[model samples]
Target: MNETGIPDDPLLLGIDTGGTYTDAVLFCERSGVVAKAKALTTRHDLAEGIAGAVDAVLAKASAPARRIGLVSMSTTLATNALVEGQGGRVALVMIGFSETDLTQAGLRNALRSDPVLFLPGGHDVHGNETPLEMERLEAEIAALAQDVTAFAVCAYFAVRNPAHEIAVRDFIRARTDLPVTMSHELSAQLGGPRRALTTLLNARLIALIDRLVLASDRFLETRGIRAPLMVVRGDGALVSAEFARRRPIETILSGPAASLVGARYLTGLDRAIVSDIGGTTTDIAVLENGQPRIDPQGASVGGHRTMVEALAMRTFGLGGDSEVTIEEGGLSGRIVLGPRRLVPLSLAAHLHGGRIVEALQKQETRPVPSRLNGRFACLSGMPARHATGLSKSEAALYARLGPEPVALDALILSSAQLAPLDRLVARGLVSLIGFTPSDAAHVLGRQTGWDAEAARLGAALFARRRDGAGQQLATDAEAFCERVMARLARRSAEAVLETALCEDGLDGAALAGHELMRRALDGEQSVTRLRVSLDRPVIGLGASAPLHYAGLGALLRGDCVLPEDADVANAIGAVVGRVGVRSEAHIGQPQEGVYRVQVAEELRDFPDEEEALAFAESVLMRDLHDRARQAGADQAELHVTRDIRAVDVDGSRRFLEARVVAQASGRPRMTLNHD
Candidate 1:
């Protein structure tokens, strides 16, 4: 489709489903971005956020939902389900390997919650194996009916020879008709347990994403939008809803990736670190060659370590809503939110009836005497406080709240069982961490001409904290933010290391060494789909309100453009996605004779060379078609690979071997069920 063919003034929706908020944006096809909005993330029903944001953006644009011709959504639903331990119950059926295989690399931890089921069937690396007992497996399945909501079947060497795995899957389908994930169907990696772990997590995540997509569909319907819906993927590409359901893991980093893509599209630059600080976290991504850097190992969800492909991004918990507590003069008061974010009732101030200095004055009225009672406050260099008269309670509170356990993580994640009083207490802290609407406005630079002082004062009030808290607190806010950033950088580097190099040989000490991660970050040189684009300018989008935008645009230090409707970038992003299908099949020989491999796709051959190659090509195309069909793809375009290897035994003879893997991707409108 021609870009100009789209409506000049039409609204294109982009939606970003983050860990904390679902933001939406409306971009004018003619003038660029037009409007934006956000809604509280509805964990109970994701659609709530989507609908809320969409309506808000529509209102902002003074347009109707029917005016939108395209819609796209980027979600962390699949990824979050895995990470938050909220996926449906799942069964891991290992066809050939035993439970013993799970002992390596803490594999046991990966499969901890999964119900492990062993079947008497498996194949060798070459696909040859002892046949499984159909009757016995059927009986086992019959009994397993009550145990799990989904099934993940991983046959030994299934990718090598999928016949047994296929047969078992067919059997399970015939019996239960449940959602089933096959190892060969998911990836082509070599590790059995790791591969199995990937499949299991995928299957488990299915239960949650199915609902997420359904909710999203319903939300679009409410807006009167009936466009062929697609979801943005982690690779900065797009895929169909049906495809998303089967491989939800791919969407783990969808939100951040979409922003990176938008950034590149806006500035047309690459090779810079994109730092997006939101309400709950700060996402740092490196762009190379106009793309986000994809984590080679793929980030882990919860702890499953699924290969949900995504750009390498560092997520820091320090956000608009982080907890803050100041132990002062032996008196401890938590800001609850964060040193930066200030809502109403900053912890220490909240404890003083929402007044700014109640907690500190209480210390002043105390009978006890301490050295801090007379300490002078220093900005660059000035007297701040004197702790000499701190009371016993206040002093002990200071010692206990001396900083360490940041309160933000706990307040936002309030549990149901916590009493209202406790929740209130937690919320006071959360508000301090969470940015208020005014603070948000200030950060986004929207409040520039209006009232900067008012915004800062409002921030102080909502946060229940005064500027002086920094003087009395153990550490300054800027230093605290830096500390959070450093930790995030370290963690992100470690995740990247595992992907750049295999984790098999790393020892405990090596894993813990910060220097090792630093070295890895410095040495990376290869290019992957997830590239960070620092070459071109980065375009920043979001509703930081007033605070983040000013210093932020400067920090970006490049040609940074904000969408006219930056707040709802997600809604526009949601509408920019597409449906895609991919198929892969490997053909090889493990032993001397019978040379064969698996085939996928609908075409009768290996694409261009198939008719010439005849049988081999035909088989190759079928597997690709098969996978496309399964992925709900209508037609497929193939990008095939043929890997030829020459192997020599240590002592003597050399042999030539060819391993063929064929892949095809296509939109899902034509033969949507080809796979």
Candidate 2:
């Protein structure tokens, strides 16, 4: 798309992996975005999704993948695996730390099993530990020769010296040739158990990530995309294919990061609330300085908590696919929505001239698939009956549905609700299946979702005149519509308040005010004022933002910043993020009856302390730079930060400690990468 002849500048291809789809983009230095495409995500073979996106985009641009210089991929595989608990067989290897240390915050009860192997050898606050316990360590390595996919070693104070951790690592490499990760290698942070958990998570995700990258690289190859691949991390940084595989956990928030990228590209507004609408859900984030706000608590995957820094984005189940239901006693529908993922039940319900889920509930309850069942603690509070009329597929999916009581809650945590619920009808779960997400979108008078009959049914259903109810209908459809809207308004307002800020102090009024302030002053809303009541204007985003948000925006009195390509917001956002990484190390000592400290790099064995520090600094800095460059960073910088902590241990005062933490970042590589 560039006017320049032969376009000498590198054309970066960016790929973002999302829950539902994989998005690809061709970007240039000066010409901005050239082409983009989206493909449904493949949970089984992730590369297929990337390949689909690549082929679609290249087909549009009439370009070959080989011509692209570099490829950067930001994915949700690690995040999803953790969130979904789908990572393959992995073992946790804890060193020199107690079982008590394993139960620390961020990762409590998340490990599949208790860690194996306990050694007496570990460093003190200063990386100086009792002499090595080589004999015991060798025996431990010998013991783990079989099952483990990889190894993670977290010693008492490896961050200080890493000698013990590295030596043990060397022993691991010599014995098993398995992927080895040491606490000191990843980050120099304290908390042996927390560090061990991070390593365990990384090890667990290795194979999955390797497959993802390999699949991605191969897919590009099929499309003649011979460029090297880069992957995005949770911290909004890019790492090499090799690096990302070893640390897949870093790229879990790739979807939101990409959206942040798109937001940056279109509006150029750094401070604002960026709302990304997907077919199934809405993702909201506060961006300060052109990036999504980073959560102070760190990245949370599935229920397992990890300290991978990421944008502070809040996700909600409220999306286009959210179903609207009415209760029998109420003048209108009870307006049941999610905490559970639906499969276009609304569309299916509409086509059947009834609520499919409700109807199914009326008929019988069944278990959903293993994939889905575990996510929800309970279904919609409905009791399950024997499998009866359902097929294995249907039953499996249903068993996963949990009890009817927990349905909405489960939906909130997953993507099932946003699925084409009408698919249920197609599969004959319901007597008369209806429209899908596509169908509902069209019927709702939106731009996306191409179900024609669905559109008709939705319009008629919402209008309350569908199915030829005629004059015989119990009540006018308009009255029903009004009632439904009233309930929906209340639910939407409540959801927004609860999600944005927790209950208590964060009332609807406060939320409305915050929303208004965030949107108007911070450029989050198209409307200048927040709606005090449901009657006020409300803004919206997603595949249908262009078609639907305007009216809502007016209601909420806020401005809307639609992406240049609003339809593929999630995909675009997936590809629009930066690749980054963070690491920290610590050491402690007590000076003259007082705890005084210094924290630094592990390679302090050099003759000059400054030189050792500088070299160690260079090690991480250059690693980050090289990592950034391999993915095509014209320029990059290393941000090295140091913190000193003085803690009261016992009574004595000696070299109590020192600690160092650093992060290196570079320009996001451009490449159509998937996985």
Candidate 3:
């Protein structure tokens, strides 16, 4: 037993992989965080970063790897991929919809150049099916299998009857080794195109997420940590790693959701606003009554609204490593932070040593400042298979690139080559190394441990650029860096206020920039002083939160709480989360005294309403209980909720539709003994 009177033999290990850093934490239920460590995230080989963080934390706590009872992880890889428009190429098979339906739910835009196959087969609201064209699918399946990594199948009204979707999924699985995703398996909602969009995204992310989970599993086995692995879902619930692999789209906001859970656990706050800043994105959400608010409509990421249930998190492309760009055609030379992340010059120098620094120095010596100054590009270390569909120009430029960073000036001779380079970066085959908030932080001494001299040189080169009026942007490098930091804080404040406003059902994007709102945020003092503030305190969670959010309270007119160990909050949340699974059934009346119940892939007819409802509740309860267990829960408890729609006719109640939902929840199972 430890000093806290709690058994110390079994500890919990939590891991969180973000865009830039991978964090690990050791925790005891009674003692809280015991030790935590962070390592630069190695995208090329995630296992390296995972091992580094885990080893460091284990060494810090002086604990044996076998002591860990449970292992849980939350990752931002799926989220970042969707945000940055990078993923494996997959084919979408639309079983019922027409070419026009592709225009719905932004499905066409999401598909990009990927292939889509349409067949005539679907079901109606009454669970009646249209004849499927099997021959068309059979004829093209072989050709489609040649280039695609996976497949997504969506059938019309699949929520009411999934037979067609199931048939398509089974056929694809039997014919190919690749994974297949079905829309009905993901959501019970009735929107066919949106469901298809979600499934396509899940299909695209399967290989990526599978790799991460497999790597973690292998690493844990090697370390002798004989514990069940759990992954955080977007709604702050935990699920088995296997479950997450099948529906990675559900993990779009996994890291942010985990951080919200951790903030509540650490601060014990019943109501607050949580903003977590990572390397690539800032996620803002609200917590009420000690729980994150689930979005009723569904989780929206990268402008694609999905049917996956998740926390109401608003993600912005503003973070420490966000690319810093100058607004074009502006006399003020206003600086803009990203919707894209870049390899910070300071970090690139730290990793590559003298080469990065020497290149920056050389760039600073050039008399004429160019738009490409202080910019470099390197291969992103993705496997060559991902580069299959690249254009000829992109292929040629990619052939010239290597693992090492090369200055943009040396790589591109004319403006025509810039677009190809950008295309390569967008495909995740390449990474851009340039000035970012991290570099600015290094220049201002707000951050350290990186190559600050390189940051200074990059800042100098950027500061010398002429604005629209042909004037230098800043008097000195330090002054320009200070401006960058100020802009970060300002953007952070806007993000927080925007989330709060949206939660209040206001038009956040419009109201957040209104003249009055701007005046209030700026603390304008005139005949009438305007002020804006959040009703609840802001809980800042991130490694860079302390450095960037110091002055946020005054801007928002509310207290900002930076909890202890906030740097590792996501990791902490990963271990403390509970496993939960929910199953739902719907009962509808086609005629008088005839009831139909739809549960998953099964559609049943009942003569009595009570009997239908009872059967649905029973089936859901049983299924959810088993699902909870499979999702890494032990001794789960089940609860049922019913929402019945009816109308009064002649003073008699008439049933329209009834929805039954069963939820199973329990603490994640842990290994009691490791041998």
Candidate 4:
């Protein structure tokens, strides 16, 4: 295996699963990134994409998979699930919550059409035990288990005392094989409804994350790779596959966090703005003192706030594969970049070569512009099981879809059918092919990875579209592509600036389009000329960063740094990061002299505050250390912090509550024998 004369130190395999691409990198400890490659992500069977990228990178490096010491991955699957409103159907068991509480924290919306069962068992804020009732749960548990893929048990004051949640979870596990998530395991916050929401989302994501892990594992096993597997968490830390599976909600921003870590590792910059542009979204975050700041107010994805700790990244639905649409009424006929991702016409053509080209060719002979000119529809290759629960119309439309790309015009019979098509797409059961920045790049000769001829044809179809004045938008494909490229650059600059302003405590949404911002970005030179620039350099990451961010420096009047291996930064970061686990315990006084300490599962009473605080710290340290080790850490380093709250009574301070927090971190454990 060492016949190639390379270093004997073990090589790490890093993979990043993104919306449009799956990237793989071979990294060495002594050297840096040895080799990297990418493959189009196969939404139908993600494992196929992983195998493709892994095989390509391994072949490029001429390395044996058996010699790999570690395989770590970072993914945007969870984030995308939240964004697109797609995941496994799960039932939420709300304990001690009235129906009215469902309105709080968007819990009801998060549940969607999922079944919810309200029970009477829960604990009070002071850990006061409530009467336990299992009659309702016993009556419905069997039937509910048969319907949903998983269950979420969220009891009121679960963070204060998880006894009720634990009971419900145990009961569900005894009766069903479905996974269960407890609210207390996710967050220790006082917001019961918010915690419930997080738990429900976590339960929904269980099957999705499990599939990803199992897919990767099966692929590795068949390839004879025996490395320890790890996954990147939302906070840019590595965790064991098992740990990640249980708390998939914590991986909401896993890909973005990995990119930030990669940005720092690649540039060695202490302070800068890191922007990672992917196929479906652009994530922007600030780096200060060699580390990115964590969002104190939990991570918010697709408008739902969850108690996931992650980098304070601002994600925008603007990327290479973002759907391109027209704003017809504007005088200039503004081109809008997406809030929705579409299969790039170039990529779609590559997938179904003759069908796509033939359809586009036929579209050119039309006398008038058709709304569905460049659009194609096809099944997403999802399992037949995913197609369940669809409405009659949706099912009918879905059944007609096949492997080949069908022109949208030919697929739908009427305009009324469009809503069903959208619903199918939202459910991840179907895909839409249309013009995107990637297709525009291909038309302009900026990219050539896919079917350039198909891109050319798709661009031409869009070019014939009529604007507000009923005039042709452009003379040809190349001319139309130029506008698309310009629009992307302008939007990317605006997104970065808006994130900066928002971080500076301003209304960035409004300021992004303000006169001053426009003047600064445009470099306007007039009387009362206004100027603004980023305080720090921008570190651009992602596979398309180099291609798209080349002009960002001039636009922002700031330095834009695109590292040499920026394309594979997320994968690189996935392998280089360390395992981190956090554990917390609470100490509160139920009476003037009696104190109660809430550890992982035990609630013990203490006679004094000092005794309670000491016990809490010990419990947190042990829990975090064990958890970190289980998460793939070896000889982990540990730290602790205590926050004790007190109240002033009659000019004298009195003990209120004390919180003990512990953190453990270390590099992921590697195998002793690479062979």
User: Best candidate, lDDT-wise?
Assistant: 3
lDDT of 3 by residue, 333-411 (tens): 9999998899999999998888888887888888999899899999999888778778999999999999899999999
Candidates in order have lDDT scores of 0.54, 0.55, 0.91, 0.90
Tens-digit lDDT track for model 1 on 209-232?
888888778877866776545677
Q: What does candidate 2's lDDT look like per residue over 1-675, in tens digits?
A: 333332546667777766556787776666667788888666556787788887887777666555687787767677667765555555555556666776686444666563466676776665557666667656566656676677767677676566677777787787787887666656555667767777778777888888887777777666666676776666555667887776676777777666666666666676656666554456666666666567766677677556567777666665544544433344423345443344443433333343334433422234321222211122222223323466555555555553232233333345644343234333323222222233344534444433344344332343332222233212443344344443333444444444445313355345554545444423444445433322112223455466434433443344555656655544444444455555544433322433222233333343333444455556656566665566445466668865543455588432434445566555654444323
Residue 641 displacement in candidate 1 (angstroms):
3.1
Model 2 TM-score? 0.73
Tell me each candidate's TM-score: 0.68, 0.73, 0.94, 0.95
**Model 2 ranges off by over 4 Å:** 1-8, 106-108, 131-143, 323-332, 345-438, 454-541, 569-634, 639-663, 668-675
Model 3, global lDDT: 0.91
Candidate 4 on 292-332: residue-level lDDT in tens?
89999999997898988888999899999999999957766
When sorted by TM-score, best at the front, the candidate numbers are: 4, 3, 2, 1
Better of 2 and 3 by lDDT: 3
